[model samples]
Target: MSTADVTSSTNDQKYEIAHLKLVPKRHIGRMIAAAIVLLILAAIVRAFSVGQIEWSYVRDFLFAPAILDGLKSTLIMTVAAMGLGIILGVVIAIMRVSGNPVLSSIAIGYVWIFRGAPALLQLMIWFNLALIFPTMGIPGLFEFRTVDIMTPFVAAMLGLGISQGAYTSEVVRSGLLSVDSGQYEAARAIGMTQFKMLRRIVLPQAMRVMVPPIGNEVIGMVKLTSLASVIQYSEILHNAQIIYFANTRVLELLLVACFWYLVVVTLLSIGQYYIERYFGRGSKSITASM
Candidate 1:
């Protein structure tokens, strides 16, 4: 009678355990937060759709001559400014990491002044350089009136390019530092000059570390070109403003500007992804081995 009773009790316990249901955990707070965000986004979409905005104006101006011209100007400035910035940044980065105190100090000061000041202020100062220097050139060889030469485009270029150099130098410096000292020593042992060593051995490797941030900075520069509007450099925003002021289609013109910016940024982001993937190939292989 006791053996039968123990066997029956064990069988019942096992059956109960097998039949027990697992209840999944609910993330109530996460669901509620997501719902709230969706609602807010829906509201914003509805507001814009039903607002007094002239959607037709936005569509028409999106591809208008003025906008296209502005876009061209923006792209030109981006390419030119970034080219200048890269040259300055590389030189400054080299100086920053060099043995000479004078060059290092000069590089530091350049970064300090440019990075410290707002881009707008720099643009204004450049635009108004005639106040500081009536003319610029070699004293006996050539001279030109500062006001004539310092047009809005030139001023914007100098301002944006120089400011970009300050930030890019830091990125470059970090990339250079990330390289192994052993590589530097090896380059030196091979009878390589400093310039030759950096070009042949260092920069190629450092590009892996430098590409991502530099790509991001390029994207940032696209948006930053809007600041040129203040100096009337006729980038998209400035052109949009001119249109809106005349037609009183401010929001529509702004929307047009925003659309173009998003398009350019999206294209740049795709390019950035490719550049990042290319540079990251070596790191990925190393990581896989580990």
Candidate 2:
């Protein structure tokens, strides 16, 4: 190649790289502000706490068998509820976006009702449902009653998941919608079936948008799992509460639970950072504007 042509090509390549690397000012400012806010909050939390705590009691009691059991229960509920929430959210998102009016209405009403109610209240009601009815059975058929159908664990899952689904539906739907309509049209034009198109094309793309917020919810659910304590499900918080109640060290035990909660949330935030990086690949495209 001629010297002039080679020089032109190198300059064009450099220009292309720099153009595609444009960093928006708003994103930069927001990132700096967020970092500063987090640092300030951490410093403030470290500054407080006039109460004296028995360190040995905290160490022994916090990790005692009952607390461990409660931690296990907390983990079990967290996983189960989030799993159920994601599944239900996907279904509801589909229904809300479905072409059928009846299906959309049902999905919308469900989201509205559940999102409007507090999860704790919902949990309490489900646990008390058996008490209210005494015996639940088929209405038209022989009302042959069965045994206790719902335990506190079952009720807690149903209440927490069902309510969470209302919020997650919107998140999933937003993710699905983030994918360009052209992508769907292209999939159909190429003779892809609906299910395959979604699985192979759309969902992969939507997940790039979905995973972040879902991660946020997962972290939130880690704390929200504390509500199970109210139903006497013996989750981490409940176990801690038991210790403090016995020892009359409410603040200290409460601190332990807070510590664990903070640890779990921080771990999740780190996981989310890597997950975002994983989904973040080749989102750029050549356009006429370019």
Best by TM-score: 1
Poorly placed runs, candidate 2 (over 4 Å): 1-50, 137-147, 284-290
Worst 10 residues of 2 by lDDT: 281-290
Clashes of each: 0, 0
Cα lDDT of model 2 by residue, 1-290, tens digit: 99999999999888886546676557888899999999999887666533366666667666778777877788799899999999999999999998999999999999999999999999999888866677777777655322266676888899999998998999999999999999999999999999999998898899989999999999989889899889888799988988778879887788778877887788889989888766766555323225
Give the Cα error of residue 138 in candidate 2, in Å. 4.8
Highest-lDDT candidate: 1
Q: What are the runs in model 1 whose C-alpha is more than 4 Å off?
A: 1-23, 285-290
| Alpha carbon deviation, residue 144, candidate 2 (Å) | 8.7
TM-score, every prediction: 0.92, 0.78
